[model samples]
Target chain A: MTAWRLIDSGILRAAEHFALNRALLEARRQGGPSTLRFLRFAPSALLGYHQSAEQELRLDACTELGIDIQRRISGGGAIFMDETQFGWELYLDRADLGTRDMSIIARRICEAAARAVSGFGIDARFRPRNDIEVGGRKISGTGGVFDGDALLYQGTLLVEFDVEKMLRILRVPAEKLSGKAIADARDRVASLAELLGFAPPLDEVKARLEQAFGAEFGVTFQPGTPSEGELELYRAALPEIDSPAWINLVGKPRSDLPILEAAKKFPGGLLRAALAFDRPGERIRQAWFTGDMFVNPRRTIADLEAALKNAAGADVAGIVRDFFSTRDCDMLTLTPDDFIMVVHQAMAQAGPERTRP
Target chain B: MTSIGDCLFPDELFYNVDTGIWARREADGTITVGMTSCACSMVGELVAYLPKKVGEHVERNKSLATVESGKWVGPVKAPVGGEIIAVNGAVAAKAAIINADPYGRGWVAKMKPANWDGEAAGLITGAGVRAAFEAKMKADGLSRC
Candidate 1:
């Protein structure tokens, strides 16, 4: 019922922006502010708090590209961020909302964001876990964190185009993205430049996001700045964030997560993939497929990977089924089951090696 | 079996309904513990899991493990007092398994109960498990699983 504070820090360096993340979250948890913030990263490769830079990114490429590689306080996969993207975040109190369920909270906020993105004349929708997409191509990806009663949810919006740069920075499924494979990426990601033929102004984008979030929560935004306490915390957290240990905090063995590759000559064409799996979790941490598979509405594979993120080992079959059952895609003579089989075969090689019973 | 907000609760499992976790006593006198599906669903997809070392004593309702899901990380409290006999190292590496088969291989830890008879009496089982969870779900405004 009350108005929420709005803070827009336009194009800050990675450390400054992440420090604000720490500052604002702490402030909100201690009952400092209930606000919405729009932020931008000045060419940075941000990794999740628990992710290892050595395992997740190609440091050489990042260094050559002059990208600032830092870790986010939140959880999830690493992302390549820069001025070409817009970041939006929200800080709220738990008691101010009715539900205590985390997934419900995520869905509600993500739906609101999707509505905001849709305002730009694209059919943007929230696709579970955390992502905003246009016709199955991811336009935005989000993640968050909470401390005591305070919560922060942040997202990245692709306003312009840059497929090669992202491929260079992230280890990606490198072998798959070479040559024509790079062209395949064009179908998986969409930018305002590609969709609208030009990048929209930052202010206009922020206004649409603010309007959508405000309408969803039935609150107005009053322009504001960080509190003094937040400034203090920002100063304190800066040193830790800039350290090498902070960037490579969760260094685990790459062998723990081996990249398994598999391919099949199907009736449609050749379909192949390189999968990075959490053998113990039986979950596919990341997946990239390239080759010749004619699926209409080209973003099908990206959507499938997004849907399968954090999926249970025993649930992969079901996830694949649900993903295909919900929508119609012209896989020609190839079925979704074919996709699952290929992935499972590759996964089998990485772990203790499961034999068919 | 118990039914809460349309979710199934096997009455055979010993449950600390207040904490949203379950325990099962083994013939050797140790107990196995895990988070309920309702708890997992509430948290969303887990990205990371960290469990206490085996042989460590854990107080009832105190955190025995920590988990991160959808970027929010927090602790999973122990349902009953005991010394952890073993941790599920497999699931620790792949936290999402805790969601897929929460009641099966997803079990978080095994504990040698400090006061099994005393604590066990207070836990809900079978029919009572369903009722207690039903009440919790209703209070939490949750529908069926």
Candidate 2:
């Protein structure tokens, strides 16, 4: 069996972490050893590779909280993370995964990660696209980047997450800050502490992940550190990655991305939705629910919002209906159609057509 | 046009099958580039596109543009070293057009090759285009367009 090097890069600032991302990916492309690295970050808000910090994060809130803001090399939505979450990343050649198709590569890595998380006695499963969830609540989110023949796949394990803090740190619709909204947010995301009644030891978490990946790829891991070559590359890369030019590489106007909203009184209760619609993309970037709707397992609303994120304008109704049909919910005096209607109403507020003219 | 499965590879265009991008030498001595139909099929509906700015110099095998779909982002590499002269504004505004009409309005960028004679040999065309793409699809484990 092949032996892969393992590196534990304890706690680092977000800039250093991102700089390492560039260095390690370059190293892999130049035929460096395959590696499994465990990492943790101080308080930070990370933007996707092609995201604008001004558009995705609340700068004042992040500054007041003393959270460092950085951009990831991988592509995905922005996320607020702190020491409470542990990060796992793999650096390997494309051939090592035996696939070049991005979706298939994501599935194989996520399935192994899901197995590792489930080893903690929680029923975790790999959700399509890129997420690991327990009982419909997401516990981990993943993304990746590639350079020529080299690839870097990374994910975060929520050891003890603060859903309310994340909602506040991001530039979500203002209504999402309410007490009830926090409760709804809590329902959609799961943490190790919330699920197991206590946080699992970091060592235990890493061991399970190491074993799972080893078995999945038929390789044993040997403890190691960054190679001399990688260290040289890291020195060369830090100057560029540790600068604002890299962080603001893809800045876009916030006005182009607006939080559109709509509300209506139904027989069940008052129903309302706030949608972060990306006009140029003609997609609902995210959806949030508010108001006095009494539904069993309130988490259903959050789950519905998760399902609606990035949904094309024409497909919202179908996706919403599909979501309700697959899950059991007790909504008093309110039908699934009502939720779909309110969401459409919110989207309509954006304009007559969601598509570009 | 040459057909490989459901994908179409116009016999006249030059292709870098490994990169899954095609180039057409325009009458004005410039080259128009776009993702092949096979590439569009492999990546589902595109949600975002970020092309390199016009007037920028891009080396061969370097990213000319970045596109995202289903939360996965990948680059469309340049087939030859060149200076980007223009980008497809229509496709930039609505990336789904790249999937709907890849070879037409969805052309990605136009460039003036720095050394066309030096790089032309690297791209495949004519009778060999179909076979090259078929082998690439098989190696990628792609079933059909």
The per-model DockQ list reads 0.34, 0.52
| Number of the top lDDT candidate | 2
| lDDT of candidate 1 over A96-127, digit per residue (tens) | 56676887788888899999888888899988
True contacts kept of each: 0.53, 0.38
Which numbered prediction scores highest in DockQ against the true structure? 2
Candidate 2 global Cα RMSD: 2.3
Model 2: docking quality category: medium
- The residue ranges of model 2 lying beyond 4 angstroms of the native Cα positions read A174-176, A291-300, A325-333, A352-356, B138-145
lDDT of 1 at B6: 33
| Pairs that collide, model 2 | none
